[model samples]
Target chain A: MTGPARVPPAAPAASTAPAASTASTAADVDGDVGLHHLRLYVAGQTPKSLAAIANLKKVCEEHLAGRYDIEVIDLMENPKLAAGDQILAIPTLVRRLPAPLKRIIGDLSNTERVLVGLDIRAKAAAP
Target chain B: MPIKPAPFRPSLPKTPTGVAGFDEITMGGLPTGRPSLVCGATGSGKTLFAATFLVNGAVKYGEPGVFMSFEERAEDLAANVASLGYDLEALVAEGRLGIDHVHIARNEIEETGEYDLEGLFVRLGFAVDQIGAKRVVLDTLESLFSSLSDEAVLRAELRRLFSWIKARGLTAIITGEQGEGRFTRHGLEEYVSDCVVLLDNRVQDQVTTRRLRVVKYRGSAHGTNEYPFLINDHGISVLPVTGASLSYSVSDEVMSSGVGGIDAMLGKGGFFRGSSVLLSGLAGTGKTTFAATFADAACTRGERCLFFVFEESAEQICRNARSVGLDLQRHVESGLLRFEAARPSLYGLEMHLARIHRDLDAFRPAVVVVDPISAFRGPDLEVYAALLRMVDLLKSRRITGLFTSLRGDGGLQDAEDQGLSSLMDSWIKLQTVEANGEMNRTLYIIKSRGMSHSNQVREYVMSGTGIGLIEPYIGPGGVLTGSARITQVAREEAMQLHRRQKAERRQQALERRRAALERQIAEMRASLETEEEEAAGWLREEELRELVLKQDREVLASRRSAAE
Candidate 1:
């Protein structure tokens, strides 16, 4: 298990502030190949939201250190964005760059499940 | 501190659904600011019911609503309800309605560990605030159970979601799939304890009927009977058989029964206004003729009449009535007469009742006719129940109902009409009396309450002009009709003519006899007069001769005396 060193547990507020801009810019520069684009949706700085952000960063750092980008969206501020992604559960991780979009709900505490959900281990095993 | 009796809470507040007869059944509508569970089997119209509730709230009650569907897309939902005449797209465009489709694909969804439905709350909150909605619909929330793997978390979140909806004070309808025995598959009824409605679409003997029942209504008095509802071009209309009460106000006014002879027979000039009249007869006994005549009379009086024909089309009825000199086509063209024709087998008894209820509401006619109600095929008791409700509905509105029933060839006590007769205020029976090798139509009032009706049977005559009742002709052999009546009348006329001729001949004979007797007496008198003249002449002669003799004797005496 990788420790959540890349994202502090209390950094959801600071990370979600630039989430909208980061999501737009990342979609703008999507010509790069083999990049893992992830978006995490949350409501405010709840423990579940912060843990999901920290755990998702830690997992990305261990599995896809320099190839992944994480964008944290706080639905409390941008509630209208929830409907566009068909969001129903908080702390949902949406894999944006994948050809087939995928959603993993709940706090990303289990590193193995997150890796499998994002199809990272399969790519690593095949490559 | 003595607990001050909880402020004596009144009845639970409700939000009217605006569905026809549904508010009456629920005494208002679903509990206000509370979640209601609408559970039914697949194709049982669960989504339609939810959509109707939301749409009616937005359009009718002026309360904006939000519809969050889990099974169908927003555009698909709008298209599906468009047939019901709900312009959901327009409502949404006007900001009176908000539709959000929550697409949850189990294949694309991956469950990691723990999650809360705060995203759903946020979305609902946003939609509600956008429209200031007072009503919300979470259609088929049970889909979440199939999409997510964690039952415990889903259940907890569902409970919280209901509370959140309540906290917002929005009347919400959450639909669920029917379970094996419970109200819903996921037991959503346990969460929506304020109101639970169950819709059922059942097929019996190849006929499908939709029924709605209020399984449980907390703190409200709702109709306990299963109400048959209809989904037509309008929307859901629940037909509550027990919704009408017996305390409808009655009118003392009288209206014509269309046939003047029949009116004369009914002493009051016609049937009492708003009274139920049953015209029962065997087949070909002119039941439709009487019904059409009554409808014509109502239309002639400028009152609207609605005719429901189960066996014949409207044009056929009009054509048949034209043969009897009833100009019903004119009334139809004038818009005072309307006919609703359908085969009795097209719908079940309750469905027929619901359709009738809908028509009555739409037309609001002053007179209604159900021609040959016996065409309805069902258990006799079920038919009776439906008819009872129909009569109640008509009477409650004070609309005159004329129901024609076809009876069997049995005697006066027709088995099918036994239960219906008591329900009718007046019952006119038509019988076909076979006498003198001819079939004669006869009509009589079996029972006419509150009026002295003629008990004598009159021969029902249908001529080119119109229907008339030939007064009862009680000949030597009882009531004569048809050729027997004509023959009896002819016989009576011939006997009177012969009696007059014989009396005239006897008077002539007596006059001749008297004349002859007078002539004979005159002849006798003439002879006597002649004899008397002769005798007088003789006497005069004798007297002359005597006088002459006396004169001679006197002259002799005088000469003697002179000589002396």
Candidate 2:
């Protein structure tokens, strides 16, 4: 939780590049690194919510491949859950894993901003 | 069905906000079922106003409300307004109120592409439905602008929200931060066009006063002037004196002016009930004493009195009044008299007016006394305006108002300079006239609107038994008072005594002369009798001589003389 325990063996040296599809299967292993845990908050399955979910999945598949876990929470079904994440806008994406949490609002249409928002590219370039 | 003409309606329907004096200024409160924008600078009581609106609706009007605060949490808001006696938590627990705190941090989130405020809508809708709320407050919705960089989307969403609120027929209040030139930071006044109220906290001469004004009310007639308001333990109360109509019913009743002598000068034995009386005097001229006497008289009659002392504490006033034989403490203890004492510099004049208005509403006293109203140091017009409002407030309730003012310079002209005499129904000026090296108090009824008051100035004297007015002494020197009057009175009495003594002495001499003359007349009569006897004797002797010749002639004469 403090830091990435260890870089996943399947992950490429340059994590900025897309990891192999098999890398995501190793996310359950202990001490696996470069695994992204994201949670998307949505009120209902509106167009914006659907688009955010699709775009978030596409960004995850393209960037980290199988190295991320996306949990979609529908606030309409569970309105009480929205307070826990301090969600004010629909289609909010919260990065819960890798220590310091982060949030990005709106449909994840811009891949570059999403990558930067999740610190994937920064973590790779700096490491 | 036959076609029917629509009934003529003068104004838009209103939802009463239940805020004191506010509804009167708005004519009936805000336009019903529409969003009203309440904008003000920070710490200007915007939150309190909104909360009062919501809480009053729930507790008083049986209307449930939803309060969505973007700045303060539910508990904080509740705690903040608890001083106003609004049990927000109790209301919430009773299902009459719903408080949702929307926490937004600018640094907590990043905007990826496009988003709307549907999540906020969901929360607000849930709260409203949960309470069946007829009122809603979105306090500071403008915070979203700072949290999110997308102003275009936020503005569009706000417009939608307003329409949505209208669609549901919910009376909503949307508070915003005041802008440099506009009414609100984001110009929320533009979206909420039904009504807009602006609150202002102005500091003048290091004193702050809160004022409220209805900037615009579409299709409704509302007061446009800035009405001074107050935020105390009871919450925000607007003093809308201008809105108070002058048509309040008048009473033909007259009440005593406390002291019997002053009442005698009023010609009617008292002042007109529900009328305002001004007691003005120089320093130490017993102005407060007169006011306290009036209060004591009112309380003695089993009527309640409210005394607002700006110069002294209630205890001090009661104690001083006691020295003059006015037992005000007894009245206080009997709950017939109430004292509200505060420093004139404690707040602005408007705040004082609001506070008085609040107290009047609570106490509903039959008489109100503002001792030494001149203690309020401010622009003459401001003080005058405040006093005018106070007079109107008291008159409208048919409460007698006795206001005392300290006359500067102790001149007749100085008393009239305040421009307050015109507002009072009766003006009593107390002057300290220095005569014969002594200062004496004199009372003059400058004016009594409906009564033929005495025009003569009476010497005012305060002894252990309270105030009394002595008949002015118009001697050769003219209008003498104090020891000068006493001396003049004594001198006139001495002159009268001397005149009476001289007349008595003259009568005694004339009686003595009459007695002497009578005695002399008696003596003369006696002498004449003696002479007559001698003559008779001589006649007798001659007769005797004759009798020597004709013996009895003298004897006959003697006999005749003896018979005489």
lDDT of 2: 0.86
Which tens-of-lDDT digit does each residue in B1-564 have in candidate 1? 111222334388888888877777787888899999999999999899999998988877889999999999999999999989999999999999999999898898888878999999999999999999999999889999999888899899999999999999999999999999998999998788999999999887777899999999999777899899999789999988776778899988999999999999987889888899999888888999999999999999999999999999999999999999889999999999999999998888899899999999899999999998889887888888899999999999999999999886547666668889888999999889998788999999998889999889899888777789887799778999999999899999999999999999999899999999999999999999999999999999998998898889988888998887
lDDT of 2 by residue, B507-557 (tens): 899999999999999999999999999999999998878769665666778
Reference contacts preserved by each model: 0.89, 0.71
Backbone clashes in model 1, listed as residue pairs: none
Tell me the whole-model lDDT of each prediction, alpha carbons only: 0.87, 0.86
How displaced is residue A98 in candidate 2, in Å? 4.5
Q: State which candidate has the highest TM-score.
A: 1
DockQ for each candidate?
Answer: 0.71, 0.51
Model 2: CAPRI class: medium
